[model samples]
Target: MPKFCFVADLHMFARRSNAERYQDQIIKTARESELCILGGDIFDFRWSKYLTEDETAHAAVEWLREFDSQTNHCQVHFLLGNHDDHPELLERLPFLEQEMKTFEWSRYYYRLGDSLFLHGDVADKTMSAACLKLQREQFAHGSRTELHNRLYDVAIKAQLHRLAPPAVYPCKRVAKRILNYMDNIGHGRETGIKHVYFGHTHRPMDHYLYQGIHFHNGGAPIGDAPFRILQRTVSLNDGENGLESRIRE
Candidate 1:
């Protein structure tokens, strides 16, 4: 038996993030868990308070190093989200992944047993998974000017990001595309993947099932929407099904 912890969209190092407030608790829970999934956007290089993108990248690595040291008993899996796909940080991730024994990084997703974990940025209505991944890869290798970064910060602070319509979950189209993606990656229905945990939409969902699969999201600690750290426990030897639940502060 092993316990799993999931937290996402903390947007750590962002100019106006509330992630710092939950730092201690996040570390405490990760330290206690057998596996910790840092769902995505754990670092917001776009809104970082650091003077330079390079400086922010350096700080992010140090934070990961400290996290690795503090959670020696836990396996930490970090999935990159849109905001965390900075070129500088992307370049450093491979090295960090090699340096830390318990730390792993993925540009796309991770599949464990009957569950799947992804950053959820591939849920667009028109784009195919391959297209979306290629677009993200292009963005990761792209550099942003200071002026462009400032504009992005201003737009976010103005809540312009919320102008888009919210997504309706249990969506058949999106679900089908996700399933197609899993099939391409060789983790389709045959793998017994019943649960999906993701972030990036910032909307939290718990065990929402559609087409025979369950979806769970640990909402971001941003804006006014409900948010909490998600926890689940399961026994590998017993072929058990785990329940997704939120941890209250």
Candidate 2:
């Protein structure tokens, strides 16, 4: 059986990262797992504030490149978060191209067996995204899209509040909506996936079951951020209890 580890929201930057808090844990997990995956925000794009102009991004890219090079025992995969804004940031750093690094960037969710790993924001209607299955005929038409757009507009407006700082619109309601839209009481099950792993909530969630499916969150791994590990139990071949979370002490 292959071992798997999923980490999220390190928020690493050229100068700083919460990695030190759980660096030892990461090394241990990486050494044991067949595959190590970063759910999202491995870099601090928002605070880094270097997403534009030449050298669109900074230190995090080089740091990741070095980290991946050093860790060759298992596959290290990175899923970009809202802050990272995809691999396009690496275009400026020609030396750190994907071809040269051991780490690989995934544009979308990563699927392993019955589990799907995503940045979590994709399911967040409040963060300019939503599960499209909700827009189907079985439900209110255009309702999901409208709400997504409306929330996106709100996010855009919040962008202007940079000066104000800490103006995060609460998104607990959206998370609930996501769970309902994905797997509700009726046959409205969105996907056949048995397990879904997501980050970006900063709240590490354990094995929460909804409609017989498991939802696992990796949470933020920086500052007072309690590092949560998504581990695949070595003895079990079945998917149940696969996401064993190692919550921060």
Candidate 3:
């Protein structure tokens, strides 16, 4: 069985992020695991502390390089989130993919057997998969202005983003929407997908069942929710008790 470590929404480079503080712990765990999935928002281009977009892009690439160098012992898969999907950074991924042997990236989702892993923004309060894709497209193509970054900094300092707890616990609506989106993308139930692991709601969930699919979310370190690293021991039998949870201190 392959051991997997799943984490998301570290939001590195953002003024509000403490990911740098947790770097050692995260890297140590990733080095120990057979596979590590960085679910997304690992870089925060939208709320970056950098003065310009180009600077943020450069810093993000260098950050990736450093992280890749440290975790070369294990397979690290980075899935881009809305916050990190800037066009400038996206253009540089292929070169990094070639330079880093143990690291790879995906814009959408990664699947292994009956389990699917995604950044989960596709289901961010959307009613239809089409709307979800459209929303993602807009975010991907959008550029953040200095004014926008400043406003985000103020919002973060005010802790405005954390004011509202997620309306629903376990987020069944998101799980259902994710399933529908998967169906639209031809990676649905028919394709043997039985479990989903995602991030973006900043809500932690473990083994929550919706319409026969088990959903898991690690939650983000920044949000009101507790940060948990999801560990999965992959096996051929879906009924096996192979999922483990460790709360990151």
Best by TM-score: 3
**What local lDDT score does residue 35 receive in model 3, on the 0 to 100 scale?**
89
True lDDT of residue 207, candidate 2: 68
Ordering by lDDT: 3, 1, 2
TM-score of each: 0.80, 0.63, 0.83
Models, CA RMSD each: 5.7, 10.3, 5.6
Worst 10 residues of 3 by lDDT: 240-249
The residue pairs that clash in candidate 1, if any, are none
- For model 1 the local lDDT of residue 206 reads 85
86 Cα displacement, candidate 2 (Å): 5.1
Query: Model 2, which residues run further than 4 Å from truth?
Result: 14-17, 49-58, 86-102, 126-191, 233-249
lDDT of 1 by residue, 102-155 (tens): 988777787666688877776654455567667776754233567876786677
In candidate 1 the C-alpha lDDT for residue 227 amounts to 69
Give candidate 1 misplaced runs (Cα > 4 Å).
126-129, 140-174, 234-249
Global lDDT of each model? 0.73, 0.55, 0.75
Kindly list the per-residue Cα lDDT of model 2 for residues 74-184, writing each as its tens digit.
Answer: 677777666665344545334554455455556445555556667766454522223332221122211133456456446545643222212231334434554553343
